[model samples]
Target chain A: MKIKLCLQKSTPRKYLFHFIADDRAWIDLLLSKVALIFVSIIILAALYHLAADAGRMNHDRQLDLIAQDFCSAINSAGKSSYETAGGNIYFFDAYNKYGNFGSGINASVSGEYVSVSFEENGRRYGSVKPLMYKTLPLSEDEVRGELMGAFSANGNISQPIPAFYGYTAVTEFLAALGTKEENLNTSMEVHIEKTLIYIHNLNGTEVKELEYILVHQ
Target chain B: MSTSLFISDEKAFMEPHNDIISTAMIVIGFVIFAAILSKTYLTYDDNSLSLENYRQAALIANDVVGYPAIQGSRQDLISAYALDSITMPAADREMHSDFFQRFSSNADFFVDVRTDDGSHAWIIDRYEASSHDGDIIAASVPVVIELGNNARCVPGTVTVRLRKNKWI
Candidate 1:
């Protein structure tokens, strides 16, 4: 009877050990597969981030080029205007105005694309002033469109999407030459001080005009 | 019966078991994955920092060339200071303190300005030996020409730099 009891105990114990070993092997395989899937997700995420970052950089570079072109044109025009008698300024709402002085202007330009209504002070004139400005562009619309498309495909969440991103720009222009604070509303971005201007763009980005006051009187 | 038990034991030992090798492969795969992840992060960080430096350089160059006291036409001034080109101006040494501050806030800059007759040349070089702080790399001087006493001519090159802490 004792021997029979011993055999029974031994048989069950051996089976239990084998069973545990088999289960452990299967668990290890599952764990490895899960780890592989997680790692792949991480790699994909990193790739997406890198691609997006590159795109952003490319966009910034293009914006810089546009800013440089605008600055150059405006500065050239301002120099000529300041040197002219009466400090005459030819105001153009971007497309509405084209410039030619000692430097030849290549094209005839005019349009309503540039927005402005000017108020000139009755008194002294500064050597510097607002030359031109155009509205800033925002990437919010494209981003939203893509996001909306994704949401529609997923058909998961029901939430209102924000229409636009917002941004603000603060620019300081020192009075140039003999330029002074005047009641010139040449740019909507300019503040009451007339030296510094703050521009708020509801669309995440917008190019605003920078006002320059002349240095030497 | 004992022989048969011995044979069974030998058979178990001889079975083609690759569990050890399989475990090693899995570990190696994880290690390789981690290494790539680390590399990706480092590359991204370095790229970002370098790009930031370039952008900062652009901003400083714009402001420096626009300063009134710096004098000279916009194109000429930019070419002189940022491009290391010659200038045609009578530059005073005292006038460039503001320019130096504009270059960088951490270090002193030096320039070699050479003037022959009415023509001027500026070669700007910065001490880029230190990694802990900002150092001068090289700069272009905007040259201003002037006739000194006895009808002789002299040109001065201005050095500009910024202060920086050791990054390490």
Candidate 2:
């Protein structure tokens, strides 16, 4: 009985240390799918934001066209042009001109919410009441103050000028613009590249006061 | 060396390792997918400055032309601005201290009115802006003013130019 010198173990400790590279649990698969869905959503959201930006840019361009036309029309307003009104409907002329602002888009005159002060007899930043002169021949400064008072609104009122000037086309477009409804969402703007004062008093003498020259000429 | 040693008796195992192939496929696939998706999605840049100033210029021009000069005393001509009154005969104290108040703004603006013929005519009925060096700001609208008396209303095409200051 010089029996068994070579013996082998049925289970080896080293084998337990071997890792199966291809094996994956079900939870791993589920997590991967969830992650994929989240990533997909993020990508799609980014794409959507890009598209919305383009749409917004295009809309603004269209508005610019309509607004420019409106400006021209308003600036050229004559004595009879019913600008800022199409038979009393506000922004009517503009609405009709651009084929009703290209469907679903409405042309409107929107106002701003401003915390304003009403003092100095409505000659400062008060309610834009009419600059009524019970007496004639007021000081130029007084008159200027009266008008500037209205222009001194808290927000920009330039947006409505082009439409008002374009649509009404009044003879004196500036002179015709009175009343709250007319001035709403609009402001009186003056850019003085040059100023001319004509003395037609006794002699037809024209005097001009030239301010600083513009860079662009 | 013996021939048996150089040439194996068993068939040569030519198939690639499945684990290695699978791992490579997953990594490459994920990379390709991510690249394509990113290319398709990410695209947003700022482009509001130019157009915005353009609109601002338009508003400023409108303000200059449409500013109300007088108040309630004359309803027949209550809310009239100097630009509009310029079309009429020269009046006394037409625009006073309020000139500074009305035109004062954070953004500097320049405005001028000229006839189509390029002669700075219409001295009696014109308002000119003071400056013109800014980005994307300037609006020139064509206007026709009826000068003289109603019996002799002369039609004139005037160009009103408005510009924002460069500093603004």
Mind giving the per-residue lDDT tens digits that candidate 2 earns over B71-138?
22232222223434453233433353233222323334444455455533432222343323444345
RMSD of 1: 20.3
Share of reference contacts found in each model: 0.00, 0.00
Alpha carbon lDDT of residue B23, candidate 2?
51
lDDT of each residue in A63-160, candidate 2, tens digit only: 55544443323222211112232211124234355452333332222011111122222232221111101111122233234434543311112211
Which residue ranges in model 1 land beyond 4 Å of their true spot?
A: A1-24, A72-217, B1-138, B141-147, B154-168
Model 1 lDDT tens row, B17-102: 34545645766776686678668867975664444333333333334444454344433332333223222132433233223422
TM-score on B-chain, cand. 1: 0.50
What is the lDDT, from 0 to 100, of the residue A148 in candidate 1? 48
What CA root-mean-square deviation does each model show from the true structure? Answer: 20.3, 17.3
